[model samples]
Target: MSESKQDIMRFPPSKITDVAKALSGDLRVRILEALGDTQLSVTQLAEALGVAQPTVSINIQILEQAGLVVTAQGSNREKLCSVSCRSILLELPSRPGDGLHKTEEIRMPIGMYSLCSVQPPCGMANRDGLIIGSTDDPRAFYMPERTDAALLWFSGAGYVEYRFPNPMPPGVSIDELRLRAELCSEAPSFRMDYPSDITVFVNDLPIGTWTSPGDFGDRKGKLTPDRWTSGTEYGVLTEWSVRADGSYVNGARAAATTLERLSLKYNQPIRLRFEIREDADNRRGINLFGSAFGDHPQDIVLSFIRFKEHQEGKES
Candidate 1:
């Protein structure tokens, strides 16, 4: 039994009431615990819990509406239910007098790239697994509907660029910058040994490169839309961070580019680009995943950790 890729789901503070309501029932809690590892049909779940099938079905429907579980038709034609996330996190808005070390977070959809230059075997799909346009057509990359893309893949070398708004206030200096996304190597069908050198750039300057282990398709992605029944399922979540000292991928130092080199300032747009250079040692290609199609329920997240003069002595 494989659990969902992301064990946690985060919600804003405003949704606490709704989330609380979803978990208020004892049956719902038991259903979640039962579905923690393996998906089960309503009848099976009812039998295991010693409850009537109709009673379980009713609760399952409520859980589905609350986004706590997702259901699909099993091979036997029965509805199969699985837990959506293992935990929940509530994000509370910061107060004005909290502190001087303010952090700004932005999430960009995978398809919202301002610029893209992709080769053949490239394509985009929404959460419903519908192709945005013809596959391998560069023109499709410019489609206005791309903003809803949940996954994008390309073979060989190519790049996608995004312009992020700088959220630092005047006179404030950025102490750290972090970018996170779920990605993996791409192959026509799928390969476990395929490797790809995925690189990231800030302000057109190379930040670092991460070597994806392979194009994985061993099993269905926990969050993958039900319509997608084939091809690669999910990707590993990767995080790249940069500070005055150095840059790192998943906390391991990978580059020496400092925050000063990025020159992040107020009113200036930050350019972030992802690419698989033609000259890369491994040109196997790459896949980018969004919240709807990845193990991680997040898009391209960019975080700016800023430090004010008065907060210089404080730890973030």
Candidate 2:
């Protein structure tokens, strides 16, 4: 990779087969995890794990070949290593009617995520604190395992905001917005209104509404819970939209953000908000699950993957 692209793009996948193979071993997983928080020498890792330097070297070689780790010249010409890519972004081959991998253009990362609570009854959550109960029950708990959390519940309605990184770099401006979440009413036993009507706001401007249908676990989720709740209910609903001016769920126009709806000054912060008000007789309240770049909600992953890929293509 060119030095400029490397500066812009943090991690690039080495090769699919090599990464798959290296991750197949337990020792290699440990080595990768050890390197996740800090860069360490082979000698340091060997001593930490009570393993031999040769063993550490062999596993690290596998990691580097797989694109999971990057070895480089450290301070004063010492060999240094650190994680290259933050996470793996999959590249799936196209099939009939498959539009997942295709994109007219890529978007850039703008800001990080932030949260704001409107009232006492409402709450906020993210990957860090998946289940943020009401302020009365401010203690956060883990949602159940992906399988067990068919639905997750919390009281009230407030905005979970995502703040994009500052200094929006040059790129094709973003025109589409997407959302993904796990959905089930209150319990695994109860079915939710498929494609429930919901409103999306960008920068406090009403963009549009979408009726997100139930996603029956055909794909792995980007933000799966680290642990499951001991005895609660949850489900999954991953949703996305393309209409720039208004909300769209299953092709019907509602409300959402438009290109004109946003103020895109360079280095300005961007905010995306998901607001869903439950109708009367709705049983489980709000159970939301999706991606949050840091601690807030927005179309972060899609934009981030595009930025990473764009930087990679520039390098190539």
Candidate 3:
């Protein structure tokens, strides 16, 4: 099955038994194995399973009833059945009615970064569409009023770092650490062909790199101010997660980085950095959009799930 980040089917504790029952039958499991990640019509499934069409259809109905499969009409009007999702995550709450098993999250504003070592073409602007300080000056990032900045940009090999306050309870361990931001490559104005390798560091450890496809500006951004008619308009919402096994960017394995190397064992602040090295193959620069300047109405966000020993044992 596809392990795409957004391709998970999460079920509540109440529905776990129902889904389990759907997979109890050997014929249904075989049907799913035949389908894999592809969709197949009843006739096609029957042929693949070497079973009668009527039998295949009956099993398909049972799987659909348990929300294990989805049926849709094909181009030729033939019925198509597919395993609903690439993977399934069942949240077994420590106690009943835990409400989707909430996780700790922090929506850090873009301008709240603690430090920045940047170069020319660096600048910041407020929500009113006014520059915070002089453009192409790294000193502008240190201005006191930068907290109100709605947009920021910088070029060359440097980074903007944030020291997030650690609020984890003593003795608790984290299962995953995630960060999401709306960003894109920077150019003179905006270029559709520019690309840049942006790397993310957590606890001062290199975790992953997401190569921005390009500086997106074909059309005006939905949240961009009307007066700001030129230059880069928007960015893509990218997510990076560090897990026990390795690091992942938008569901794809990005690197061999894992939580153990992050030095997150202690309850200390997390220093996160987005850096573009001087030797990068694509050094187009970086553009970070705030809540008021990007297509997405958000800045930088950090989130994670903590696993207590008892809860972990119960879940396992």
Candidate 4:
């Protein structure tokens, strides 16, 4: 057991049953162990656990609710997860506090590279639709400037969206909130010349779709090994909000977040999604690109990064 911020908060070992319950699941326990010294995403964690990404997400949810783990939004809206490294304090149940609410600060992976394949009819173009590329060849990939490229695509199964972490220093009131993303497609037209109306979702709520204009890139892109050569033209500057309970593109309050958005507790998990309904887009296809850009020796796409504190909050 550990000491508390005040003499009042103490948690006896008997009360640790909740913590024990939180740690009871084999997968949950493994997550804590695997996170011993690092942070990982649902995709990475799934790969490490040898299971589907959603499986790991479900387990992470359990751990988060139990206060055993915490999560943040990573590049591409993926969940970045890490264990809560806090000391436990045994306090009297009759007192003001019980168990341990103290938590460690969590670090996350930074964005580096991304790619995506949009359906047909979406008109895959560059930053301007003037140079609409051709995606007739499914084996092609775009060679946009490494510094400003992020892949965007549509899926009937839908894509997971991640929200960046906004730290609230001590006691600051957070009223209005914003969610934004830079997106583009692979094919010139989504499908049969249909437009791929992509939408964003945070915590299972709809935000909106590609609304800006044109596509990404300037013209025929540079060639890269193991990538598609013929690309399409179409792109957008997507944005969402919780304000109006609606989705929008570019600079609009597609949706709005009240206290619920800012109510997120430290060392807890959050969920985001990029959803495309079946028969909603042009081609009904998924495209992707594998890339990383930087002079640094690390993976171009940000790997999961984590941080742990030996002491709880500052009062330990």
Candidate 5:
């Protein structure tokens, strides 16, 4: 399946009623079928479906609210609508009357790190290729405007740390934690052979290191802003998960530091750090990509799954 199709929108039983309502209409179903093949404007969809433009517009609004389709204004100022997902899965409760299995997710902007220590050959840019300050200046990382950056790169060794709120309730315990980011090796221009060992740490405990294959700039990133050029174009979207058993990077075992070893506390926030160590076998440096500069339209994502008090005690 394509990446867009793989992106599933899951709804709980409570929201199933709304989804059912949205699908009950025959016109809406036809609209979705038409959009599945190609993006169309309101006028085009109306003509293709042999319906009036106003009627199509109304149905499109309903689909948009149901999260079935996404509509945006085109350069010509016409509304363009497209299907957002290829499939919808209704997620039932794990057990009858068990209530909802709550999960929390947080998206940290690429340049919103609270702490950073970088070396030369480092710089930051926004979506429009607007440089924040002098290149290789460590102080630029501290500027207030850094939060607006869509891309950041560094040579040699450095680390950026972000603090995320621990949303686990007082009695609840985290069952699993996952961190996701777009990353790649850093080079003066673009080098497919460049490699970098990028490490991730949670609460100062090293979870694992992922070896970036190369710095990719052969073509424009699918979502990279048009103004961005002469810089790194894209990167691999990497995900790392930590559980009680062990830690895994992209589904492969990378470290033995499990959730228990991290000793997470409910009152304290979680600290996450991404680094390229000087002594690493591959010191090609690192490039961090944000939604505006990468093929994937996402920033650093942190997800937490919590278990009930009883289950937590049993596992502990």
Candidate 6:
């Protein structure tokens, strides 16, 4: 794929130090995270970060010097700053005694999912926490602007899938693969004891299942808008990993599947499917958390681990 179209950004090892230094400050990192896609004036950034404008300006200068941020004169000659990249990633080989190999991670916004097969009570909201189409309507999922969804939920068994492009070099076999998301059961009412059997599939291969405890509306989600109080709030951040031994959820063995059995192709798209099987012991439904409305500020994430020397690293 062309550099302009690449999903994950890769940098040669020569850039490790500079990038690391630029990202070393917590305030600068927060600034980048808050910038998202739209340009934010320095004052807006300060307000969002709860910091003074001068503090934000100082950090923005550092980011500008490192080429990670760009500034433009806005209305009234005010300076607006924005991150230059959608995401930044770095791969590192595992140190001795660590249980893994080299790893690369990517965060896929919930709305960027490539496909879906959902049922009613299914709807999505944008970053502002406004419903995109209509509540309890399946047609909402088909809207062209669904990519703006910051939170999605449904009431029955089905799946939402994402197709991640494979960027590894030829012959680089993965030792382990992990998918993490903040999710829970979806209910019309906040049912604390409700259980949903949520399953994850990689490239159509079943990895494992996680039983979400409930819809969890006991408290407002850390990032959820104040206006969203009656609906499900936050979800549990869960991780499903397919290792050399077997599939694991939250560090416990959950399935008998193995890494090699996944048959992850080196040059083909990797499809991730999250479903609540029709015959599942518990079909409480599913609620997928997104960066803007979840207690955990992230969408679905995928991590690739290579036990041996990664050819792609050298190529970068």
- Most lDDT-accurate candidate: 5
How well does each candidate superpose onto the true structure, as a TM-score? Answer: 0.67, 0.42, 0.66, 0.36, 0.70, 0.70
Candidate 6 residue-wise lDDT, 280-310, digit = tens: 9999889998888879988888998766654
lDDT of the candidates, in the order given:
0.85, 0.47, 0.83, 0.44, 0.85, 0.82
What are the runs in model 3 whose C-alpha is more than 4 Å off?
Answer: 1-101, 306-316
| Alpha-carbon runs more than 4 Å astray in model 4 | 1-157, 163-166, 169-171, 186-194, 211-228, 232-234, 243-248, 256-263, 279-316
TM-score of the candidate numbered 4?
0.36
lDDT (C-alpha) at residue 315 in model 6? 40
Residue 271 lDDT, candidate 6, scale 0-100: 89
Let me know the TM-score candidate 6 reaches against the reference structure.
Answer: 0.70
Q: Write the per-residue lDDT of candidate 3 for residues 1-316, one digit (tens) a residue.
A: 3553238788876566667888899999999898887879999999988999999999999899878898999999988988887678886744532332335677888899998888888888887778898988788899898999888888767889988865554445578898999999888888988889999988778788899988888988899887785588899999999999999999999988898788774457899999998888888789999999979998888886755432533454
Per-residue lDDT for 1-316 in model 4, tens only?
Answer: 1222113423463356556676788988888778765778888888887888877888899888766677899979989987665444644433222232322122222122232333333222222222224433222224333223223333333343444343433232233234434444333433223344556555555555553222334543322212323343223324454432333445554445443543444344434445555546432333322222111111112111112222324353
Off by over 4 Å in 6: 1-101, 307-316
Error of 4 at 51 (Å): 50
Candidate 5 residue pairs in clash (backbone atoms < 3 Å): none
Lowest-sum lDDT 10-residue window in model 3: 93-102
> What ordering of candidates by lDDT runs from best to worst?
5, 1, 3, 6, 2, 4
Candidate 1 per-residue lDDT, tens place, 1-316, comes to: 2555367777764455556777899988998888877889999899888999999999998888767788999898999999877777876634321323256689999999999889888889998998898888978899998998999999899899999987665555677899999999999878888999999999988888999999988888888988885588899999899998989999999998999888876788899999999899999888999999969899999997756433433458
> Which is the better candidate, 3 or 5, if ranked by lDDT?
5
For candidate 2, the 10 contiguous residues with the lowest summed lDDT are 93-102
